[model samples]
Target: MDRVEKQAALFNLPETIVPHSVLALGYPAEENKEPRESRYEENRVHFEKW
Candidate 1:
């Protein structure tokens, strides 16, 4: 929080511009994982009207 606050203050940014938390991630250990199940369905939409 301190680091992010300093940066934001230096730029004179508004509080809305500051994030509640910042995440800096490294590379994942494994690349092989099952694909996630999608939440959406394809055939729900109508062509021209609902």
Candidate 2:
């Protein structure tokens, strides 16, 4: 077992793990500055007939 697993066993906690690739591919670390309303408006497409 690794250090993390060893620590979890010591503290009686489950070993929750995330892959490094996932961490790299996830959202940016910086805070999102764009307003939600504007973003939704910009991305939305109105369907004339559905």
Which of the numbered candidates is closest to the native, going by highest lDDT?
Answer: 1
Models 1 onward score TM values of 0.35, 0.26
lDDT of 1 at 5: 88
lDDT of each: 0.62, 0.45
RMSD of 1: 12.1
Say which candidate scores most in TM-score. Answer: 1
Per-residue lDDT tens digits for candidate 2, residues 1-50, read 46656545554553464222211234678989984553446344333311
lDDT of candidate model 1 versus the reference: 0.62
lDDT of 2: 0.45
Candidate 1 regions off by >4 Å?
19-50
Model 1 earns a TM-score of 0.35
